[model samples]
Target: MTLEVHGMTEIQQLAGKDLGRSAWRTVSQELIDGFADVSGDHQWIHVDAQRAAAGPYSKTIAHGYMILSWGVPMFAELLTVSGVGRSLNYGVNTVRFPAPVPVGSRVRLHASVIDVQPVKNGGVQMVRGFTFEIEDCTKPACVAESITHFYP
Candidate 1:
């Protein structure tokens, strides 16, 4: 389910809230290849399926940044900020890929509003924690603390 909030006041009240999980999304080889093409990171483990078949994960794996880049879209499934002038991705404080996301795997996001602080100009700085959980995997594919500034 999506949590809807309007304006800075509503956003400020979200401190320490567990926003919930997003729906599963498949990690396809084509998608991985596309990302590699755009990012110029055609690592053998990421794009060479034939060579990757004999590699560590036994298949092509998605780049950590590819998974990180999904933070916005996947997080949109859990929360929506409306009635604001704009929302800006401030940055990520930390990010780690604890496990590889193999092609043909499914991943979902588990998000929490770790903190919300009032910033200058009637804006709110929100620290959102994200865990990209890979289906059937013991460790998460990615974990991060993404910060955003919402202005009214």
Candidate 2:
């Protein structure tokens, strides 16, 4: 379920709040190969299953950036803001890939609001923390801090 907020003030109140986790999404080989094709990063560890079987992790793994890019969609599932004329993804502040997401692994995001501050033009800037976790695994696949701007 999404954490609904009506305005900037309500959004600010979510600071330090854990919005909650998203539904599990499986990482398929097709998805990885598609990312490799579009990104021009056909790394063996990510796309070559046969070769990666002998490599570390014993299987082809997903690209770190591929997992990192899921923050926007995943975060949308965690929260929604109303009464905004527009919203922009300001940028990413910090990112880490702590574990390999092997092909066929299920993953989900756990999100929290780190901070919120008013900006120019009656907008609010927010820093959100996202932990991309693998099912049944203790270590996360990726961790990222994303900044966003919402204008009323």
Candidate 3:
């Protein structure tokens, strides 16, 4: 279940809190292909399954950005702040890929609120730490500090 907060006051209290994880989602070749089409990144390791089979990971892998892109939907399973007029993606503060997410792998996000600060125009800026783990793997597919703005 997602954690809901009343307003800015409640959001402020969320800092330093680990919000838990999302459901395990599979990274299929179709998903990777779609991301490749949109991103124009048709690298063999990501799109050419046949070629990728003999490459680095021994199979196709999802693009790093595609794995990182999982943050929003995964975060949706974590927190929701009500009483806000609008919310905006303020981009990422930092991102790293410790391990690759091979196609057909199941992954999930474990997220937490790292920091919260007030921005102009009655909005609150927050830094959320997201760790996307490839199920059954020792390393994480991605670790990112994403920034967002919530307007009241």
Please state every model's RMSD to the true fold in angstroms: 0.6, 0.9, 0.8
Question: lDDT of each prediction vs. the true structure?
Answer: 0.95, 0.93, 0.93
Which residue pairs of candidate 2 clash?
none
Inter-residue clash pairs, candidate 3: none
lDDT of 1 by residue, 17-130 (tens): 998899999999999999999999999999999999999999999999999999999999999989999899999999999999999999999999999998999888999999
Residue 12 C-alpha lDDT in model 3: 83
Model 3 misplaced stretches (Cα beyond 4 Å): none
- Give per-model TM-scores: 0.98, 0.96, 0.97
lDDT of model 1 at residue 148? 98
Per-residue lDDT tens digits for candidate 3, residues 53-83, read: 9998999999999999989999988898898
Cα displacement (Å) at residue 25, model 3: 0.4
Q: Say which candidate scores most in lDDT.
A: 1
TM-score winner, 1 or 2: 1
Query: Ten residues in a row with the worst lDDT in model 1?
Result: 5-14
**By summed lDDT, which 10 consecutive residues of candidate 3 come out lowest?**
6-15
lDDT of 2 by residue, 1-152 (tens): 98899987898898899999999999999999999999999989999889999998899999999998888898889899998898999999999999999999999999999999999999989999999999999999999999999998
